[model samples]
Target chain A: SVFNVPFTEKSSPGSTPALSDSSLQSDDEEFESVDALEIYDLISSISDPEHPLTLGQLAVVNLEDIQLDDSGNPNEIAEVIIKITPTITHCSLATLIGLGIRVRLERCLPPRYRIIIKVKEKTHQSENQVNKQLNDKERVSAACENDQLLKVISQMLSSCK
Target chain B: MSLSLVHTFTGHTDKCWATSIHSKLPLLATVSGDRTCRVYNLETKRLIVVLDDDSHSKTLSSVEWKPTGEFPSLAIGSFDSTISIWGNEEAVLEDEDNWTLMAIIEGHENEIKGVSWSHDGVYLASCSRDKSIWIWEADDNNEEFECVFVVQEHSQDVKHVTWHQHENVLASSSYDDTVKLFKQDDYDEDDWVNVADLTGHEGTVWSSDFEKKGERVTRLSSSSDDGTIRIWKILHAADDQPSIDSKLPSTIKTDTNQDMWELETILPIIHHGPIYSVAWGENGYIASVGSDGRIVVYKELNSKEWQIIISQPHSHGVYEINNIKWHGDRLITAGDDGLVKLWELAL
Candidate 1:
């Protein structure tokens, strides 16, 4: 079971609280200002590592559940579930794709969010583990606001530009 | 959202092996195992011309653009032991209706595997299974062409040849597991000579290319049957001419057997497939396809390490990838599977 917690009331950085419905609706309007659909569209801008098309166009990113926290009546946490596919089932580029997704998600999502990446339709060995590593790193880094990811992304964009 | 398949060209009965897109023009040229070369117009989705005959005895192996020009030209080589040049003369005509056959190059005794046109489109270099490479220059009349020189150095069949993107140099790879560089110098009678012979691959070197990444520096990429792709950095000679052998008598006017060029190797082995095709990509990345049907993306890391940025496998083994044509941000690849695929890497 998932619940949306309102961000209106500030808690200590390290504290974890239970999720409820009545409290989340109060702060929901401000958070909904940035629609969940809009966030999904933003993440879809991520491209395929080998092809010249977006992950959305290639149908590589599949979004399933959009869960929220309700403890604060309106300030709820957004939990998005996603699945990824490579150009080929046995592609060694799965890691790169996962990293690319993680990077793009961090760039588009709000602060202190949890994004779950589930691997589907991959029969190749170790694909799930590699995808998990990529998402886990991003989730932890985003929660901690790791400076390395910022530096890496900035450098990459500068070079590509 | 749903992705729809665009128009499919069904003219080639056999597998398509090579494709070259005129960067500044809307023309696309394809060579196929059917032993024919066809030119197509992208805007009209129509077949413009077909150039094939008894001369192309076997499969057409490669095709390349003659740089960029208003009346652009094309060069095609085939396994039938011939290289043919095709172009249009619209610049000098009122009605520029069709592409015409410009010249037929018949010199290589064995299968002519690849052809490359110099930067100015004034010269062409062709390599073949006959273990020789030939250099041809456009005639002063501009309507005809002739063989000016030949380099017979590779011990095995020469598989691919590519002109330096920004210089008067050519690079060739062979079945002997080596890559050789050729350049024309004015000092000695023989204008063409071998400069570098890069040796490292344990299997056949199937394809090679020279891409410019920085000022006067080129990245040399080679795909081999040994299941690996390799990269090398070449520092062009400052004089802009190959070093002529002082030992060779200056009086000798035309000795085609002269060996006078020099080459140095940089970087290390990078891919894990029998690389069949390699092309330059935006932002210093080099894209390569191998026999494993995998498109391996590689980027240079401080001149020593080349990171495998991506390894995308096609559904089947890709026997030959003759060309990788870049159309703006998109890259189109044609393989042995008879399918042309487009790819873009996510940042």
Candidate 2:
């Protein structure tokens, strides 16, 4: 059952960094509206960091929805949900991919955005690590407003570029 | 299905998953769930390298030698979602005989299933349960490896990815019951195009091997959960370049591309259960093992008579035989029973 659940706030995958407050915007509704295929195309551009192939071509992107908050004002925040698979289920690459996804999303999407990238499971107990990874990225993305955090995310992205 | 243990190295106290043999070096590299990878000398039955000091917390799934020249470098994958490259032979000679960590590749969302070095050893390919494939290229001796491409094309857990022995192409199989082939021209950018998608197996395809014929001709043999072994040919009899639009269309293509490529299935021989492993043996013989606990040997006779050499039920109820590799003239079979059995044909 632990595997079926998506991203969680805790798991021992080297403490995931939290996002800084500057980039923090109003939380969007649980569901967001973004094209799954388009998001897939963007994230898939991030290489495996280990292999020379694209994650999209390798079939690792598990997508849900990208939507906006419907609270007091619907245009306040944008949200996206995505699931990523490592080449191997036990791989340490999840954290990097998660971080890469957050940086890519923040760079590609509009401002005042809230992206929730969860790790979906294909087998029992597989999503636990993915959730931890996503949580770690969320914390870092939250910290993205910081000059230093933005620099790290930018360096990470530029290294791939 | 009765598994007869041929060899069992009981040194490691954890689960062993990754295994590879160096073409020139007389050694074997194996990674374990114990967060350590052990190197062994088969001739002396002695421990060569104990890659444990700097290992992962969880299990390691795959390990391989760089496909280039004879170097003591190794590429390992783990549950921590990282691929660690080590070239500690020189460092070992200087100090503690340690295998220095060359690079740690951080990507993938789940555990990695397989890692392979290209024939030229210029690149590394890894697959994960996240249903994706990652290809990394080594720049030089001093620089760390970088991610060149990420292929997310499978619909389920990708179990294994194998490189074609002589070509720049790579093949991957997954729980989604499809095997994809990819080729990159000159390794220019992050884009590695998907050239073909071979289908037909109803269950998961576990393992595949590329058979070398002369210079240009090659054959791909795959084992599947559907309890069958199928062979697909990569070269045609006509010419170097055939019809461009004859093959299956690229799976990643948008509606803009009208050209397609085709891969005709040459033979689909049935076994008894899920075929977990496949290998190419002597004299055009293709061998496969499955959950049926049987090792079926099939050979193509004059392009017509595909005969079964032997279907020895080696394990009980298709014991979890994970892989079968050919070492010289003998066949080495490994399974969940923790046994590595060797078999020879009694001609």
Candidate 3:
């Protein structure tokens, strides 16, 4: 079950919490607030490259794993941190999956929002390497430039609704 | 054995959203994020007119030419929640400055995403971010338009609306990850109802176009955010069967009572990114463009399967292609690079 966490309540860093009912209700007036559920809804449907199921269905992205830091001022920049769990301990496509999630959120979310995508610690053997690649701006841009890799990444995201 | 770039029309200062070519005239109309619509002469490759004014305060998303009207006209959809119709004055003697604003249709609450004229040019369909598709009918005598129907079945943003080549049938693709078919009611002149909801795409459907084989709309092609292009065939039920006659035009309505459309083929992983546009060319070809900046053309081989005939990677040099149109035997494409490129099939 997805953990129901309130947006107003502060949780420990890197904690995963399912969005609460209040957060979901605030989505209707999305222009004023950036909720944690909105970020979950964006990346949860992304299809795993090896499986037909989504990242959310495979338990790669849980509601409790999404954290949002919205400055009190709506005009200020907001931060969304998503800690993903690989389907397997040594899943090779974790970085691609993270890139797919990053691309989707970048296209859909407002520019004022900053995104941080990383693999959960101790979830995979190459957690540090994958996290560094995903968060590295130059590495992400270079990876996106590779035609063959982009094709595979696009296929992984094709299942997103 | 490769398609060659024939010409490139560079004028738009912002990302070009859509392109529409005139059926008879050597003209093309393009709309852009710069809040302007440009008309170009294909033969001379010159900008004939620029339809930019303070009236359009937001980006223009789509443009379509009236196929069978008395005078040449263009329908433009903008982000300002309005659709504007421009008509060329027949009585005017000048070549330039003849286009005038015929009407401003304001029904959509949000940005208008697409606008298309029926093959007969008697009706126009517009879809919007408001999750509604509005059908407008023109009154020939008064030159005014009336809203015939408003379809709110799509649960999310409606991205594109297209009409069949030979019938009054309309197809709409939406962010709801579904494509819907709407046909006019036989008994009620003003009524249009949804007949089918195609829901195979796992992502938002970006665009859809019907294939005109001879005089029939035998197939439909849809491009989606899933980076795939799908083909669906229309099937008519047997006369003896009890069919769901949701609504079909009277011209093709037989005793069968029902018509259904089934997914025929899936061109999976055709692009490296989300496909934004797809068009069925008159020369028995299909072209698709996507976020990967590639324009790929396909042709059916032996009526069984489709094969990629031309694959132009980096057609816009890393710029996402938003729309494409078939002008005569040539193809015109617009993209985020603010340039329009034309390609011709290699004979």
Candidate 4:
């Protein structure tokens, strides 16, 4: 069961987290570096897997929780780490929600970005387990290949800008 | 040991997922996100034909060749939740449209990850993200497949399904971080039951394969996301005197009977990331591919230890290899680079 509790009122998808479309740039053009705010926009509009609300509206994905390290190093691997908080500690849909956010970022970000998603510390009852399951690359890839789970994730991403 | 690139089969515009080598012929079939299965002849080192259809709307995940056919028959699993069986019974000599769809098996609620045919090609087993493994009974006519059993034992999404090379045992790896083996129950013989649960891997088990035929009992090789390869050996009471081997842990036992399978050894870790596929070649070698874009081959030093004979980094360039197969003495690999490569191993 989903606990059915709304944490906050709805938020708009038009936050200032969006960056330009990188595909249009030619080889000579400089690459636009990604920031935490832009990463937030990619997932803020994602619909919650449990409730009929955007993650932004529910305050599940805050801009402060998103961390990006795309500093100007051509050889260095960039990183994006996001921490999400469940409405309740015992929520059963925590892992599914985490997976949804990871999928959205994977589709939008460049391959150079290493994504690390986890439940906020001390929020979930089984915080360590949830964090471990969310960040495992093998399990993440296999979960994305699942048909039923993909459908649910697609629904969550449909509202994204 | 040394390795040399022997052949490269190219044409896929998108990532290729898996490849299947013909049992009797020198033909290789590869499935790709381009929605086509390309068959390449090893002798000519060229693609023979591309089997594509407008009916397929999603990427094909896995492919397998039926063992006994004079003309090759392929079983392809797709992301669109359908398994299409294609046969070349009436194929001409190098025609573009040589293969035709024979049957479409649909029942899984979601995408099919892996598919396998029994050693004799009598049974077809498929695992899906829906967390179910369905066993279908197939015949030689390339028609009507009946679903015999469906079981949901894995707690999470299933990754790969494989059959024993010499027996009827079916093994599946999953996102649940464990490998479960299934076999027909003796009381019914028609119903499939979970016989054993291999519980030691701390992360997801990506792929598993059986040694062609062991000296005493069949051994299984399982590769995992934890970046390690484990070998499982079946400890039969009849094979060893005094009920069991003194070295094996007494806790090993399948759910049904005294047939216990224990983790025999963990191969040397050469992969820094998740291992996607593992294939036990008939040449007494075990080959593995992983996310780090490395292909490592291992040989048994004894039952308790294995040595890395060949560790070739960047076998598929910068792309992760999805599947690996052994064609006699050579190795075939499909990768995210939209290429299928053949390599010769120097033993």
C-alpha displacement of B154 in model 2, angstroms? 1.8
lDDT of 2 by residue, B1-347 (tens): 22234445444433345467666666667665456777766556467667776656556767887756434778888766788887754523223365677778888887777888877787889988777899888865624677788998888778788887777678898777888877774346567877677788877788888775655436678777676667776544222334662463756323322213344444446565467778886456777765445676676775545777676764322133556666565566554333345566555
Instruction: Give the fraction of native contacts in model 3.
Output: 0.00
**What interface RMSD does each of the candidate structures achieve?**
25.4, 20.1, 17.7, 11.4
Candidate no. 3 TM-score: 0.67
Candidates arranged by DockQ, highest first: 4, 3, 2, 1
Q: What's the residue-level lDDT of A140 in candidate 4?
A: 63
Docking class of 3: incorrect
Question: Which is better, 1 or 3, measured by DockQ?
Answer: 3
- Model 2 preserves the real interface contacts to a fraction of 0.00
Candidate 4 per-residue lDDT, tens place, A1-161, comes to 11011101111111111222333222103334677887888889999887889998998889999988776453334667899988889988889989988877765654335678888889999997898788765456557655678788778878987
Q: Residues B172-282, candidate 3, lDDT per residue (tens digit)?
A: 998788999888877887888787778899777989989867675678899987789999887752322334443665565553434577888876356865788999987
TM-score of 1: 0.58
| Best model per DockQ | 4
User: On a 0 to 100 scale, what is the lDDT of residue A40 in model 4?
Assistant: 84
TM-score of chain A of each: 0.55, 0.56, 0.76, 0.79
Indicate the residue-level lDDT of A30 in model 2. Answer: 21
**Which runs in model 3 stand beyond 4 Å of their true positions?**
A1-161, B91-94, B237-258
